[model samples]
Target: MLDLHHIFAMQKKALFFLLALCALGWGFTSYPTVFAGIAIGACFGTYNFWILVRRMDKFDRSISEGRKVASLGSALRFGSGIAAVAIAITLPEYFHLISAVIGLMVPYVFLFIGVFVSSVRNKGN
Candidate 1:
């Protein structure tokens, strides 16, 4: 089984770095709205990521204990993503809708990258 804690840690680090970049973009670039959108989306994405991790842990525990696992809260995550989009839509001047959508995908991107890196390192070892 994969180490959830380690994976989550890796993702958190990546997300923080991304947030820093967004901050810089907001401060130095003309497209402050775009960066702000991304930052907001990323915050929601991080929340979703944390929820997924918690659900996954519960799932693993249920499996080990021979109990049925509940749903993974996909709907909740989906709703949050929608809420991010809605926020951008409602505040058009403050956020770019497209950029907000892109921000919502940040965590998943980091997830894949982290897994790939982990696999490569394991292989090397």
Candidate 2:
């Protein structure tokens, strides 16, 4: 069985790689506004993920102990992205809304990469 912790570690590395990718974005896109938008999204995604993990941990523990705790991570994650997009759209002259929207998907990008690599690697068995 694939180690879950190992997978999460890979995910973390991928998120950091996304951050590094921002430098490439800034250098290649020649639009600091877009890059800034992406950077903001990527940073927020990282924080959102961290918050999600913690919230899940707490919720899981509560469940194991036969209790229920409301999980707000999902709302927070969506809320932050929507808020960022709103900010970007409202300040068209400052940030590229499209890029910001794309940037918010950084986590999913890493998620697909992890799943693809894991499936391909395990297929050799």
Which candidate has the highest lDDT of all? 1
lDDT of 2 by residue, 14-108 (tens): 76777688778777876878887887777676667666767777887888999878775898888888888888888887678888887777766
lDDT, candidate 2, residue 10? 72
Question: In model 1, what lDDT does residue 114 have?
Answer: 81
lDDT of each: 0.91, 0.75
User: How close is each model in CA RMSD to the real structure?
Assistant: 1.3, 2.5
Highest TM-score scorer: 1
**RMSD in angstroms, candidate 1?**
1.3
Instruction: Score every model by TM-score.
Output: 0.93, 0.78
Of candidate 1, the 10-residue stretch with the lowest lDDT total is 1-10
What are the per-residue Cα lDDT tens digits for candidate 1 across 9-107?
A: 877888899899999999999999999999999989999999999999899999999999889999999999999999999999999999999999988
